[model samples]
Target chain A: MTDLLRFRTDAAHEEPAVSLDAFVEGQANASAVRLEAGDDARVLIPYLDRIMLVEIGFPKFRDGRGYSSARILREAGYTGELRAAGDVLVDQIDFMRRCGFDAFAPDAPIDEAVLTRSLERYDYHYQPAADAIVPVWKLRHG
Target chain B: MYKYDQYDQSIVDARVDEFRDQARRRLAGEITEDQFKPLRLKNGLYLQLHAYMLRVAIPYGTLDSRQMRKLAYIARTYDRGYGHFTTRQNIQYNWIKLEEAPDILADLATVEMHAIQTSGESIRNVSSDQYAGASADEIADPRPWAELIRQATTFHPEFSYLPRKFKIAVIASAEDRAAMRLHDIGLRLVANDAGDLGFEVYVGGGMGRTPFIAPLIRAFLPVDHLFSYCEAVLRVWNRTARRDNIHKQRVKILVHQMGAEAFAAAVEAEWQEILPNKSDVPRAEFDRIAAYFTPPAFEAGDREPDRADPDFAVWLDQNVKPHKHPGYAIVNISLKPIGGIPGDASADQIDLMADLAERHSFDELRVTHAQNIVLPHVRKADLYTIWQALVDAGLAESNLDLISDIIACPGLDYCSLANARSIPVAQKIATRFAGRQRDLGELKLKISGCINACGHHHAGHIGILGVDKKGTENYQLLLGGSGAEDASLGKITGPGFSEDGIVDAIERVTDQYIAVRQDGERFLDTYRRVGMDGFKEAIYG
Candidate 1:
């Protein structure tokens, strides 16, 4: 099992990290927190310092609380490495980056070239995130 | 309608791909049905009585011709050549296959649409008046605010797991066409003393087994604080709303138990704690969002009365309504025939409407909760031609406020929760009262599939509720229910009737109202004065 999942964005001054295992059973968490294990917010904020890797827990990718959580963590001052862990597929990597995740860890082994191509599927930036990337709204407004 | 920027498009595209992968996993036995049910529902896919049903969101009931055409395409290709426009202003394709749903969702994503939050115990589609931006009496267009609210509420971490589903409706006009009074949160845009827009917010109002008109929580809330205030309300509801009993889980029941004043006080306390937070909508952001909804450049025309064309005059009296613009009229496209289903529109009809909207109405069309469509911004000069086209398309019946223009839910035919069939009841009532529409005047008929009251029968002037009597279908009639400014639940008159006898019983009540009404009074007014006694006798006797 991969112990660390790294998430780095262009906006980060240095690499920042989080650990999925420490996030799973934290003392500051409540029952609702455990129920929402796939949520990044639960582990993202508390485990920001000592961790260098974060997992995108897709109990099921259809349950997209993880995507929003990943975005939230990235927005809330996390910058290191992000990995899509369980149920992660080749198609979701492009969006994962737009939402602020940087690394892809598909359930099955993925070819690096194919994964890179997936990241290049869309050439435009749209959503605002920790990456400080120029968004489509800025282009339109400017 | 607000066009989706690339951000919106990307999110929808990503979501579609995600659902497609999820569907593959389900097929591969990677996820159980229990695990996949909520997942599918969050994407607006439902496993109904027989097959999967896909509900496509029509945000705030505002759709342009292009979106409508896409919906038409979906109906023709993926569905049974027809779609049902729901009370929440979304369209549902009931006969959808589980395997085909992913492709359908992909098709929808291409149009910058998705079914996210249309179901599940989270914020459902935010609905507003179909005549939202186009209504003449509106203080301001409410769609931008609705859109802002939609964004604020969509997948908010704290709100995704609420006690029950939440519904919010915003209406800017004095006449509450969106039935704001029956929503979980009803926002009425109001102008303050300085002629600036604010909201008169109502909370805890909903219809189901126990119907309650939302009580006024805040008479006037600053427009800038809309998001924060809503956040406060939801937070309070999440913490206190009942979760033990599914029947009493709605915020309405909680409000009823605690009383509206106490509920409002609790919400106020919560709001006080969060007043200085980032959730407070910044003035700049409000202005930015509101800019998208600025009315199109409407040339000022003569306010002087022209000699009314006889046909145009009749159409105006029955269908066209006053617009805030001097020369423009808000036109209703009647979905009801003399005897037809309340909200079902064929693929062909949908296509024709798209064409008509593009040609005559600034490329905008609105699907009302009343199961009718509105070409909300038609000019007076073009009204005659538009009316002719609508008539040619078999859509012009001039029954805007008539008895046949009923609100009926997809009862037992579609919904698993229904106790009895409501469509046939609505059809029978419409047919029975077709000849007497002119005499019936402004009667509002609302029918519910079951006591859940999706049809909003409880709030209708003539409310029909379908009930199951030991295994047989029976119907109950309720009188004097109004979903207007002075909204009230209808009072059940007497005994429930067999399905066959119910329409005649309604006809008898209508005949009674006609005979005893004092000079052009509506059925509701007359029912209020004489009470249910006279109507009960007329129906039962």
Candidate 2:
């Protein structure tokens, strides 16, 4: 990460909903959990109820196992807050949202204006994600 | 051909500016060779064995006369008075100075052309059939969609940092002339029974150290969903493709390990979640792009002349093809000459072709995957004049799709990955088969420097694979291969041959075919009719 970009975390606002640095690993954690169909309800139910934030690891930028983990958690009714951690970049924020990440912790500082501009860069939408946004086709044709 | 809009022009201009800055920094010693290496590559500048080679992108193999003339100017000014058209539908100048490279790029930008992303891990040039808009057998013109895909994928944020290089090709015809099946992702334009336009998507087919033909992921994907589907595919690949071993980083390896079914499932799942998002291609946008590729106004006439002038007839039989328009024909300009470098066009020849393209053709030129140039739309009446000009320029040889019209990679002479020199082998074979052109009919001789198959030797009717043998060069011969309608990989016949022995071995194989073929049967057809047994026996015997 020699040419890496960094962003500072805001610690003044009541610890916030999700910390950019935390790495979540439990079965109930949206970003790092891997669950089987037959997991015990006792363990799953309690963990699902208690966890409020989850951190997704990229491991390497290409290794997207964490994206699936986040999506599965979102589908499984975990609605607290989702944040991306390791190897995050400005370019991946749109995809991160589609995979159920609500907040991103890109290695570079968050340029709110730039981020806002990028969020609306392309008006067309596709794929069913946590955002449930309407694709451009539906807006025009439907 | 798709014309460049403001966005396309701006992008090229910006890229030239960026490369100029990088060149300046490198000259000033602000960056080390290692640091500047990838940066230069991303801008399509390669430090080859001799000098810096600059590869200029000809998107989807389509270019107008203006761009072609500009290429000629660059060739005359910055290069060794010649340029090589590569298998990727790009042109490479072998002798480019670091100082002059930026100026050349600036000149190219004037005609809305620049050599960006022609090399490097980023999305390389998107290639399509050279006969894209005019081929008679094509279902629809694939250029507009190819252009859309090119625009969407260029400098795409999520895909810029992939595990390895990625390539995508689109074919709109029944025959895969562009060899789309051998790319990272192959898109075949097709119309469903319901008359809906869509694509048959193939994933992970590529030629490299590890060669794999792409596998089908979807039977039919609607045209509007093109971007979204492609996005889903890249996301899955970017996430799961191997990273540790550079050799195993291509999407093909991942697709192989995951199996096409599992890979398709992963893509579907990702698509399901993202289909509701903001990246899908809109129908209007598709129309906007497609409108640019509409066929030019054609005058109706009998394509066949009363008696077909002998020379024109010979050229038509070999070089001209049936165009979508009845009166027009697609003219394939063969770059391969007997004992000459495949794909090399001198500045004078380039300028001559450009002038002819403007006067007789539709002012358009295309670079084919087989290392040749093409004039996509030429009128039947202008055939003789065009042929005469081509002959005067030393371009007309009436050897299109012939043995001497070989496809060869720039082997040890240029490539860092080559084990043997490919150009010399190509030269030897071409010379051996020269003057005997009438004897050797409709045979494709393709040679690759290494197994990476840059020259597509595996798909040739007579395939030549160059390998290093105990610090010496050797060539292996493969027969019964086809890159067209019935595409199949060639299988090795027997033991490898030394450089001197390879030409003789190829001669033997051709002689076997000449003896065994039915009247007027193609080499590939003959090989298929009587399997490799006969050809193998002749070679090994």
Best by DockQ: 2
Worst-scoring 10-residue span by lDDT in model 1 chain A? A27-36
Which ten contiguous residues of candidate 2 chain B have the minimum total lDDT? Answer: B302-311
Residue B279 shift from truth in candidate 2, angstroms: 0.8
Give all TM-scores, in the order shown.
0.82, 0.84
Error of 2 at B140 (Å): 1.3
Which 10-residue window of candidate 1 chain B scores lowest in summed lDDT? B302-311
The digit string of per-residue lDDT tens for model 1 on B29-122 reads 8767865776688778887777788888888988889889999999999988999888888889999998998898888887777888899777
Docking class of 2: incorrect
Regions of model 1 farther than 4 Å from truth: A1-142, B300-313
lDDT of 1 at A24: 63
lDDT of 2 at B211: 72
Candidate 1 TM-score to native: 0.82
